[model samples]
Every structure is written in structure tokens, then in C-alpha cells.
Target: MERLITYKLPKFGFPRLLAIIGCWAYLALPSQADISLTFGTYAADKPTETVRKYRPFLSFLEIELSKALGEAVSIKMVIAKEYEHSIDQLANGEVDFSRFGPASYVLATKKNPDVEIIAMESQKGQKRFKGVIAVHEESEINDLSELAGHSFAFGDELSTIGRYLSQALLLSAGISGADLQTYEFLGRHDRVGTAVGSERFTAGALKESTFKKLVKSGVPIRELTTFDNVTKPWLASSTLAPHVVEAMRHIMLEEANASAVKQIAKHGFLEGDDADYQLVRDAMEDSQSF
Candidate 1:
């Protein structure tokens, strides 16, 4: 009879076998299994309040995105201490997406050209919003010129309305930073409003929406001047998969998501691009305070 030979494969330890199987299983899984989107925003109010306001909307977003993607899409919010920090997180891919003030978006684009504006906030069906310089209703300050030789508060140093645009307004009124008696950054629009209303600040700069909300809530502040309108943008890192970005854009534009969008923006959202915020970038370049 012809000679026959048999070969035996080496046996692996149980733990080793499990580890090898786990590696292969992980590698074999769909890319979505490893995907999670982190959204970042500069603190527009108290950090906890800001997170509270956006968490429900983010949950809604997660559900919608999961349905669209046919996978368990995870979403989380990161609250940055300031606008520049938010931009930094977006630029370095620490956050996959972000909501930005017009000026912050400009700064982020400068830091990372791959950052893209995917959508913009809208109010009362309008795509633009303005900033305001306000003082206690009883303060003697009447115009930007009157702010000279008086203490002033700005919401955040990198704020579009609270700094750059408001500075432009002051410059137009022929008052430069050197012209002010003293100025300080109060960090948030609510803080600026509260400080000005309490007469702690001679005047303050903040977004018009915050000013209106504060006034409606009996803050006793009045707008001294308003800045030119600027477009706020929702930005995404280019590192995100194209399909993921597209899904976000589509969901934001959907009529069904309007209410959810309103929790963050009074109006909703509109499709937008980098060009929409070029004016903000130009303004920053033109401002000395920036």
C-alpha cells in the first residue's frame, strides 16, 4: 500500500485564542461601529445651562442620524471655556463638529482650512443676526461716544458681536480702545447683561438675542447701539466621512428637525458655506481690538 502522512496544527492557549478572535472580529466589524461624533461649542451661557439646552437637541440628532445611517450613531457635546478653545478643538479633530459665532468660525478656518461651514442659524426666517451695545436703562450713556472714559464689558474676547463687531461700531463712532476708561471681558452674554444691569459695567456688548432675552426677563437694560448683521455657522471637520457630513446637513435641513434646531437657534438652520462668513473674517482683519 502507498505510504500516507498526517499533519497536526499547533494548539493555542484559551486566552490567546480569545485575544486573536477578538482582534479579527474587531477588524471585521463595520466602520460605523467605531464612529462617534463629538460636537463642541463655546459656552454661550453658564456651562451647565448651555449643556442642558443642547443635550435634548443632541439626543434628537443622535436618533435621527442613527436612523439615517442605519447604525447606532453616538453624539456628545463639549463645552469650551471660550471661543478660541472651541475652534482649537475643531481644528485638531478633538471635536468632529462645532457651532460657532461668525468670528469664531473665521478664526477656526484660519487655523484649519479644512474646517467647513455646513449650515447657519436663522431667526424669524432670516439668516442673519446682529450684536448690541447696551447699558442699564437709567445709565447716562447715550451713544458709542459716551462710552469713552467709562468702563465697558465685553462678553468674550473672541466674540464676534461682543468684541470685533462692537469694536468696529466704536471705531466708526471715533472711539478707540485707548479712548475707554477701562474695559473687561465678562465671559458670557448673560454675565455681561447682568453686570451692566447691576450698574457694575458702564456698558456692555452682547448678541442682540441675549440682550432681548435679558430685557424680557426684567434685566432693565437698553440697547445703545446695534452692530451690522453677521452669519453664524455650523462647522464640521473635513476628517469626518463625507456620508456622515451629508447626513448631518440633510437632517438639519429637514422640516421635521426644525423644532429641534430651534432649541439651539431661535429660527432654525439654513444651508451655508465659508463664503457666507468672509465678511466676518474681513472685519476681524480690519479691527485693531481683535
Candidate 2:
């Protein structure tokens, strides 16, 4: 019987037999699934510039997640065309995760309370940052109170610093939308800066980073007021697996220190709390009347 079976089996050399056994072993082992995630955000800048600024961070995150999980990982970036659309996408579970500004974060939670904050962006371990109301360098509008009856520029309507917080500041100074002779939501920080710089608008509100960038690029804009604002928060969808959210949170807090992407949050991330956004909520409430 043994002799008959040997004859029936194809002749195999020692190396070939070992190779067959190895193949069988590999086949028998269970496969580890690849981790694929989609990251979402709004293009507060130009779409191409937003992609350029975010691609490196996504690549870095994928490499780190792969190493930490012992499996291949990939993160795809989805940039929304507008701020409100980005909020809608997150609330509707169109993406796995997102990085939302404070105002948009508040709005997203309102739309879907299940949205989870994974981490908040930090600046050198600090969780607070600055927003600026900018005016053309030669403009006589030296104060927020001077904005009355002058054309004002704003970024996306949902922008934290550019709209909500800036509006709060203007309200504090006794100015309202009707107080301005003209105002427009230009849809981007760069546009707001350029509008003010080109003398199209008398003053504009934008994040401090964008204000500095425009000034450095010779846009001839200067800060009229600088106000404190909460940093951005990274959020995960409620529909995402809990394990994946935990793993992503861990990776962001642990692996982001090695990230060299200076265009975004350079210092890494910190644990976030809903209470951290109370100021934005307050500002939003105050802005409703404006």
C-alpha cells in the first residue's frame, strides 16, 4: 500500500517537499486584515494647498499605525469643499475620523452627539492658540470698535476664529453685522487676508497662523486684535469600531511626536474634553444674534 501511494504521488525532492510544506503552512495560517481608514477635513485653504499640507501627516500616521498594530495600515484624506459640508459629512458618518475647528466641532456634536473626540491639537504642550482681526497696514481702523460702518471680511461661516470667535470679539466692542456697511464670507483665510490687504475690505478676521503667513508673504495686513481660542480637536465617528478609535487615539498621542509635518499641528496631540469647547459654544451663542 505504501509503495502504491508513493508511486501515485508525484516524485518530490527534499527541497521541493519542504517548499510544499511551507506553502501549506502559510495557507493554513489566518490572515491579518489590513487597516484602512478615511480622514476628513474642510479645505480652509485652497484645495491643492490643503491636500499638500495634509498628505504628509496622513502618510506618517499610516506608517506609525502599521508599526504599532503589526499590520499594514493606510489612511485616505477626504477634504470637503466647504466648512458646513465637512460638518455634515462627519455627523452623517461619511468618514472614519476628522479634524474640526472648535466651532465646527460644536456644531457637529449638535448634529450628532455620538461623535467622539480622539484628541485635540496642541502647541508645544499648550492647548490654546490665538485668532486675529487684521486690517491693512495703512488702514486707520486701529481697533475692533472702529470696524463699524467699514467693510469687514470673514472666512468660512463655520470657521472658529474667522467667524464665531471674531464675531464675539466684535460684539464685545459693540459692533454687529448691521453695524458694518458691508461684509462678506470670503470662504477662506487667504481670501479674507487678501481682501483686506487689497483694500477691498477694511478689516478681516482669520486665525493667527494665517495672519502671520499673509504678512510674511507681503500681503500688507496687520493684526488689529489678537484673541484666545481653543485649539482644534480630532474626532472619530461613532460608527467606527471602538478598538479602532482607541488605537487611533493611542497612535496620535504616541506617534505624532515623530511627525515632521510643520504645516499642521507640529507639537502633536492631547486628550480632549467636551468642556474644552465651552468658550466656542458661548461665542456661537453670542454670534447667533449677529
Candidate 3:
């Protein structure tokens, strides 16, 4: 296994380490609860810097959830500047709930085995997603194998289709992450596409819907193509009880409620089981074997 476990460093030292490990073991024993939830996101910008400008869609997320829950929920939205840190926070119970891509969710489950996936997103009601290796229309790269030594941009290391899928494709094509001349994290899909189009990166990964949205908004569709494709979907995290999971799942399937979630991330939550996320688990195992 890749052993993508997340650990917390106690403020004291060795004694606290033993205690924390023991506590984790105890929590892994499993319990149930009905409690107010706090949600976290990997989207918030840095703390000490000016916010990364974006559309006002986030306000709608807060508003819609509040309406659905019929109470003020504590949403501790923060930027996941580092993927490991995001998983660590979730593992330590610093955040009770979160959303993650396929790779991050798998990594998180390793550390917090009790963590439950609560929801998943889809596009046009389709949960299957793919990774795309895109370049400018005038660029020379035409295939995943041709990307060697070329500069690239990844959305985030924890991204399912963003980085992991693209990397898997590259590795399958006999290229390694180290073979890249340079690579950068543009943070989000839009920036990744924009960076590639502006020549900051020779090629990059993009979700299919993001590409379509860009084109629909008047960006040139001829700017990119699929060098490779990998399927991924949205996932939710919860350390709550099964009843809670079942409740949320039921609420998410309500057509009006589902529509609101879909508007937030281009996909709505759907009923899922352990098998629904097996692709991510399998990919993680395969990546670690390398």
C-alpha cells in the first residue's frame, strides 16, 4: 500500500505521541453520535495574502446549506494550501466534514479509517469524470508520451483527475514526474487552463466540464485536446454515525436539494457505497506499488 497516512505531532513530545496514537486506536474502535457539524473546504485562499479573486458562487453554498439544514451551520472554510495538512486536519477531528477529490479521500481514509464518504458530485447527472492533457491549439504536444521534458501545471497534488490521474497516465506512458522540465500548481482548474493557454505551462490537466464551461463562455475550444483521460468523481467525508450518513444521503437525493448542490460544484450528491470509491482505492494501491 502507498501508506498515505496522516499523522499529528503533539505539542509536547514522545509521551503525547503515544497518547495520540492510543487515542486514534480508541477512536478507530467506532462509536456513533448526533452532533452539530462543521464543514471545511480546500478552496479558501491563504491567510496572510489577498484572496484569490473568483466568482461569488461560494456565498450561495453557505446560503443553500443553511436553508436546507434549517439552522446556522459552522462552516470553517479554509484553503488547503497543502494536501497532507488537509488530510491531517480531518484525521485529528479538527474538521468534522470536508470534500475531497479521489486521491485525497483515499489518503484520508488510510489515516482515519472511520471516516465515511457522505456525498459525491456529478456533471449533467453523470458522476464519471476524466483527466485531460491539454495544450494550446498551436502547441506541438499531441500525446501523453510526448509530454516528457515539457513544462506542466497540475491543479493540486491531491486532485483526482487533476494531478493523480494525469500522473498515472504519464507513468503508464513511461514518463515520470521527475521527467518534467518544470511543473506548477495553479491551484484550480480555471487557472490551470489559463496558465496552459498563456504559455506558462506546456501542458496541463483539466476536467472535461471545466473545458466545456470555458468554451461556452467564449474561450476558444480549439485551444486544447485530450492526451489522456481518467475517471474521477466528487466525494464527501464524515466521521458521523450511519444514521447521519443515511439522513444526508436521503436529503441530497431530493430533486430541489440536489439541484442546489449541483449548482455549487457542477455535480450533486448521490447514493454511494464502498464500491463507488474503489477506483480511487485501486489507484492508490497501484501508485504505491511503484
Per-model lDDT? 0.83, 0.88, 0.62
Q: Which scores greater on TM-score, model 1 or model 3?
A: 1
lDDT (10s digit) by residue, model 3, range 16-99? 878988999988985532245555456523333312221223344445455555654333455566667878777667776666
Model 2 pairs whose backbones collide: none
TM-score of each: 0.86, 0.86, 0.67
**List of clashing residue pairs for candidate 1:** none
Show the lowest summed lDDT stretch of 10 residues, model 1.
281-290
> How many steric clashes between backbone atoms does each model show?
0, 0, 1
lDDT of 2 by residue, 1-290 (tens): 45544447789999999999999999999875488788999989889998888898888778867877778988888999998899988999998899989999999999999999998998888889999898999987777887889999989888998899998889999999999999999999999999999999999889888888899999999989899999899999878889778877887777645455344678878899999999999999999888
The global Cα lDDT (0 to 1) of model 2 is: 0.88
RMSD of each: 6.0, 5.9, 15.9
Residue 266 lDDT (model 1): 74
Candidate topping lDDT: 2
Give the number of colliding residue pairs in candidate 3: 1
The best-first sequence of candidates by lDDT reads 2, 1, 3
